[model samples]
Target: MIENTSSVNRVAVAILIAACLFMLVPLAVAFVTATLDYPTFLRGGVTIIPGTHFFDNVIEVWQLTRLPRQIFNSFVTALGISLGKMFLAFTTAYALVFFRSRYTIFIYAAVLATIMLPLELMIVTLYQVTANIAEPVNWIANIGGLWARYFGDPLGLKLSLLDTYPGIILPQIATGGAILIMVQFMRTLPRDLARAATMDGASPLRFMFDVVLPLSKGPLIALTLFFFVDGWGKFMWPLIAASSPDMITGVVGLTRLDFGEEAAIPNYPLKMTGAFMVSIVPLVIIAVFQRRIVRGLTYMDR
Candidate 1:
């Protein structure tokens, strides 16, 4: 028995070491790629050497690719999606928890059903609906005559919400994952608490705002952080939705470098630098919120 236990422990240690390496290798590669020079990177394709051109590559990406604007767009779109997701999830979960009826079951079933459906299947319909929704410009057009000024010189400045902010924000909001998470979480909350709140003259809204939301902080924060990271990392949708390269987010900017039209030759160093610049904030946020996320996941339904 003693010998068997010792062997098991050794195996577990080996597995842990392998897992750690698997996780770190990609990050190490990306960092090395980001740090190397063009000549060095070209010679060592798919491999990286430690050297000094890190800052130069980063600056080149920023100047050539309009990385700042991409980051900004990413932030804006992520904020909108996360906010919409939070509200929808909270409300859906609340309803499912409080009102267990056929309709509720149907809604939950529908959401679960969507989980099996591939997102690629929905692209055509989504695109059509997106194109049909001509984004409302009342906010911009009304305030400062900005709309006319922006489009007056159409040669240089391209304007429209077709592949713009609204195009990105709205589509993300109509999803069901957030609602499903909220519903699952709300089920864990004691029914007695909601009932007590109701007995104490609290409306459903008050119960949710004052009672449920506070209890849900763990999951909510986790979801927000996830959405933020996902938004920053988003590439395909933004590439399709954004009309101009300038309006595209940093995630898409990385791919654009690969299809080098001129003498750019798909600079790996610059691509990695762009990726790092775009990805660092979301990574930092995940690291900072790592404890909270774990706590939220560990929470029991009791």
Candidate 2:
């Protein structure tokens, strides 16, 4: 029985290794393909063997178009999305967990419902909203502008978020999973902790920032990683919202590269190189913080 069990365990380990490698096939193809020369790439459907044009293809991909600008735009937008989502989720979760009222559960339910309505379904609506988005501060600015014009003092608020970074970030910030995770974590905290903080003269906000959030570092960091990855990987929304080349992200730019051109018939290496580079950041982030993620997701008696 012991020998039989040992053999089964070995087989399972082998199978797991095989499955992991199977999952990496596309990534392997991309990297190997990026190394091949244009001519070799055209002839070889999907080369597993690495070739010699790796650096050359990457350099060409970087220089040939607005790839640098597109990458920069993506980084900025992704950072904004992650920070925005974390802020909104943290505040909302805090409110729901600490300041419970008659309608608190209802509000939580409403927010949770939004997770069901993904970006694809609301794409048209979001596009329309973004197309019309203007800062609310502009209303006050308009009055000030007129007053300044009439009285010879100029006050200005020329802010329109549409087709801009802020516009791209805002619509994507309505996150429900973060709130759910936070609320669940908070519920596990001892009521005596809150009472002790209250007695020690900490205001609700102060307690939240100092106590609750400090205790929640693990979960917050994990969620931040997830949010950053999701934000960086966004393609469809950015594609639809930002038609201008200057406004588009790396994903959109690479996808829209002029594959129609005759030269692009064998330009797979350059394209693959760009794609690998774009994916490298997220992959590195996950690898570095994977342990934190596992800890954060594990339910413990905190």
Candidate 3:
């Protein structure tokens, strides 16, 4: 028995150490790359001196590239999409889990099917549809201040919906992946609580807000964190949907460095610096709310 326990402990320690190294490697590379001297950056890989140009690089990226605007646009677009999806998810999950109907299984299956269809394969058709619809609607909405930035059309600008905020936010909300997650979380919820709420004369909306919404804090936080990261880090969709530099997501913007049209060699150091700047929000979100997420998961498990 003692020998078996010792073997298990050694295996656990080995696994833990390996996992820690796996997680730390990328971070180590990013940090090392972020601080490399520009001239010597191409010599090979991994330098550790911590660049003096960190602030200069950040300022240039922020001022010249309009990273701040991109960040803001991404935040607004992502928040709107995330909230919209969450609301849809919550209601759909609530109905699917709490209500019964002949078509319930069919509806559940249909929702599940969406998860299997990757977004990358669907972009071309999705973009065409978005572009077609955005014309008239875009014309109607861009009459005011920042509205023109997103939905404006004058002097034959034609109100570009392609590579714009609405273009990104609309399709994301309809996908229903987040809704599925919420639904899965909702399934484990005891049916008794909902029944009790109904017995106490609570209406559906009231119960959703009061009972389901309150209990769903964990999934909500987790989803929000996940969505925030997804929205913040999104590259391909933003690239496809929004062409303007001001609308670029962090991942997309960082990728532009490698095109190397202007520079002689790839500016890995600058690229890494920009990456770190973009990564700040997701890190902050995780740092602050990770405990809540763990707690929420624990609650759900119980």
Candidate 4:
């Protein structure tokens, strides 16, 4: 057994306390700054002294910004993205793990190769595709002027996914990291379970639903929460994809908060308040599922 010395314990406790303080201090400052009114904020400029206008500022932000609607949009987008990623990852990992084929390694390699091509790198091409999903079909139809010869014009078919939920969620769902994690986790399972399920006349789908899926609850929950937070924090893609103000997300909406005219002093206090408000949902989710998150990540039953 490892020795548990008092001095070592004290040092660990001190480090934990320091880490907590490091994280909380900024939050405290933001809260304090958010509580101050415009005049008080202008004069004091981000003080630790708490003011009494927290509710007043909240009301002002609610009225002045489209944050409420954007928050709802964020919820829908994030939830859809999370579920989509989880389903794709789970099914892909399942096939990679359970299906024995000559090309399995090649397929896994191809899937993992996509991690190199992030959304940012190919965003322009993605936007083009999202703008008109049937572009490929149009190209094929107009190849060698085949369509123009018959119809007297090139094939022009437009099926846009822009400004829609599918456009935002579908493109973001192909997560290689989640698939990798699920594959590694599934590899750790007892091989005899699969053999026994086969002997008991259980089909692959039945075994997946009744056996593997049930045991994978921990990892699934962990991945869902992780993806949800990721989807929620996405700014650039959502900003570009969503043309209308009604479809903007919380993060984008937070940035859109007007800090007054170019000549006037920027309203830092109100902006901080909006930041804090936007952060609430994710913070609450992490706090509520703290233990489960730890357990799932570590793959520990305890």
lDDT of 4 by residue, 35-65 (tens): 9988887787888789998888888889988
lDDT value, candidate 2, whole model: 0.82
Look at candidate 2 and tell me the lDDT of residue 225: 82
- Which candidate number would show the highest TM-score if scored against the true structure? 4
TM-scores for the candidates? 0.81, 0.85, 0.79, 0.91
Overall lDDT per candidate, in order of appearance = 0.75, 0.82, 0.74, 0.89
Total clashing residue pairs per candidate?
A: 0, 0, 3, 0
Model 1, position 34: C-alpha lDDT score: 85
lDDT (10s digit) by residue, model 3, range 1-302: 43458888899999999998998788778877777756767775676555566676677667656566767776877787777777788788899989979999999889878888877889988787677775555555555544657545342334446767777887877655776777778878888998899899999899999998988887887676667667777677788887777777666766664423366667777777778887878788878877776665455522
lDDT of 2 by residue, 171-212 (tens): 998888877888888888888988999999999989999998
Task: Candidate 1: list runs displaced more than 4 Å.
Answer: 1-3, 40-49, 134-161, 258-265, 300-302
RMSD (CA, Å), candidate 1 to true, equals 8.0
Which is the better candidate, 2 or 3, if ranked by TM-score? 2
The C-alpha stretches of model 3 lying farther than 4 A from their native spots are: 1-3, 36-46, 134-160, 258-263, 297-302
Once model 1 is optimally superposed onto the true structure by TM-score, how far is the C-alpha of residue 228 displaced, in angstroms? 2.1
